[model samples]
Target: MAAGAPRVFVSHLSGVAVFDPNGDQVGRVRDLVAMLRVGQRPPRLLGLVVELSTRRRIFLPMTRVTGIESGQVITTGVLNVRRFEQRPTERLVFGELLDRRVTLTETGEEVSVLDLSVQHLPARRDWEIDRVFVRKGRTGSAFRRAKGETLTVEWSAVTGFSLEEQGQGAESLLATFEQLRPADLANVLHHLSPKRRAEVAAALDDDRLADVLEELPEDDQIEILGKLKEERAADVLEAMDPDDAADLLSELPEDDKERLLNLMQPSEAADVRRLMSYEEHTAGGLMTTEPIILRPDATVADALARVRSADLSPALAAQVYVCRPPDDTPTGKYLGTVHFQRLLRDPPYTLVSAIIDDDLQPLDPNATLQLIAGFFATYDMVAAPVVDETGSLLGAVTVDDVLDHMLPEDWRETEFHLDESDEADEDNEEVAAHDS
Candidate 1:
């Protein structure tokens, strides 16, 4: 089913007869399983908790379901007879999500989650609960059907939350600040009550949480990381920049740090482990393993293309490290740096090797924080390459990391305020001036 296809509300699927590709009745969809994601992104529809003829329930993954039309689910005849065991990440839609009281972002009026509409994402087997069918009245058991002020809105429109008090959801709180920068979001997380903070953090996707984790104070990082399931914690750490991930891990007890590292993908774990081996304030410790690395033969255009990635921080993108054969850090013999400006000035076909700034001295991995800061200050450079004794590029240290280390510990503790009134006033004044 396409994303644009009509969404089937979970209420309509209660006990919906599921059939095989040959049109034989397999079972009925007792409940839909969904895995909630971080932030306001929709929860993924994992599969159906189908009760077979033998009265044994099994999980039929969305991948196995080819179609859900005419009130019948068509499966690929590949059903896992194993009992449906809900993982820590899975939520049974009928059991947990429905009939919850949530609020509208616009009016802040509470509504009952009568049903959730799941949609098949375009060109993929994945499905997600994209809309919430709610009624502006009292709440009760899940899947309660009633008529009064009924309307279906995007999932975001509901007062999303899983609160210890009342029924406000974490997604509701996060939706209010969805556009915040990671640092700003970290500030919001920092000031929240511990329980609320963890809930909010848990709702964020791994990559986003990783970005926020990097900005948070060490204490906050530890607290939040501890609250997450180990598997998820490892995943979040893997998503973070290697240097940042290492720093967070180092704050944990040795046992915990090692456990998470082992759970991470081997390559990602290796990078974090290598970074942790360095002195906390040294170039090796501060340099990110995933810098823009290009070979000597790579064209200026190639270097430019790598630099333009939205994933890279501005400081990291400010230059490309030209190394020899092994492109992965610690890359083969370090050649020299090619600044972004240089890439722009040269023709696209020009070799990055021909315009190398070899005269610039690269920092040793063991270079001190003060030394790294001095190097950046002296050259007016946003980033610098870190080379080892073997003339290999260990990684590149961006100025942001240098400043992060050099700044006072309390710098990140400053309270964040989103005051747009001044900007609004300025805009009004400018408008008035223009009108006059």
Candidate 2:
């Protein structure tokens, strides 16, 4: 069937029906699902789930579904009913793949399949298999196997199907923000409009929201924060990196900022405030308060213990910073950073400094956005330390923050620009003076 063929409605179909490709009766369609809002048209058919024997179900993709005849449905592919009916260790074959990694040939990158697309096939009176699309990242660009791309065989691939389990998992979506590559997340966010960005953020839980927020640009952070309810906004901010939280707060109106800060827990609010106290363009302002700081004398085992207790960001670098006692020059007199990957192979009792990288590329407090962008491009650094003139650590600026300043014109609204033009016209008195 042509891709753009006009859609047809199935007649005499009171509800959904399910059948195998070989024309075996499976189950009946329960409902047609869609996203409908006020002023929006009724939800279109996306896909259907057939309730087979013993509560087993299969998703029929909308693309492969043709048309429905009287009491019969047509499908594009042939499926064995027994393969879908066998029970695997996991209750549902589809559910077992949730959160599992899959690679897409189009991008030659791996992504987690977030959600499966299902649609009703009226011709077969059954659901048909659709292309399996993977969630690319939080920004919502999905990775689909291009036409004719061979599916690579892996232990994770579904070979023989089973039907023992017949229900959905707690969270049926496969891919999540934490599982996405930072670069992919950035790409996705850059492409999303403010409204779409809000919808995506609203769909995520707090933790997932925090993960994506940390990877997004500052303007995006501000835009998304503006759209969320005060409580949800506060929750997401509280869960974000301290430096990121501070940057976002700085961009918000004073009243909104204060309100959100007040809504946060005492500890989280304090951390944000401390970060905010620094100048906006300074290193102190950019450094995250959540860094894994440890004593120079601490052993690998001790550092590992601290890591376990701390709520480390998922995108943490391979290194951990070694610090002196809490003092005015705590970060200025930094010992070094221990490479985390090395620690895994080294003795547990090894001193942290023994594995530290003293030549870390640190940021200066007065650095400009352009300069930061240069650093990000040159060093390919995910995170960099920011320090004051006194050599004291202020905060850290990350690649995501730098990218925020480089956003394309479409990312922000033009209302302010239009207002400026209006003001300039009003200020020009020559035309008015001539008229007078």
Model 2 lDDT tens row, 196-308: 45655665678767777766666777788788899989999888877778877888889998999999998899889987886765556656666667777889998777666
Instruction: State each candidate's clash count.
Output: 10, 31
Model 1: clashing residue pairs?
38-203, 38-204, 38-205, 39-203, 103-159, 160-169, 161-168, 161-169, 161-170, 162-169
Deviation (Å) of 165 in candidate 2:
34
Q: Which tens-of-lDDT digit does each residue in 350-371 have in candidate 1?
A: 9999999999989999999988
Off by over 4 Å in 1: 1-168, 415-436
* Candidate 2 deviation (Cα RMSD): 19.3
Which residue runs does candidate 2 get wrong by more than 4 Å? 1-209, 212-233, 277-285, 305-315, 327-332, 373-380, 407-436
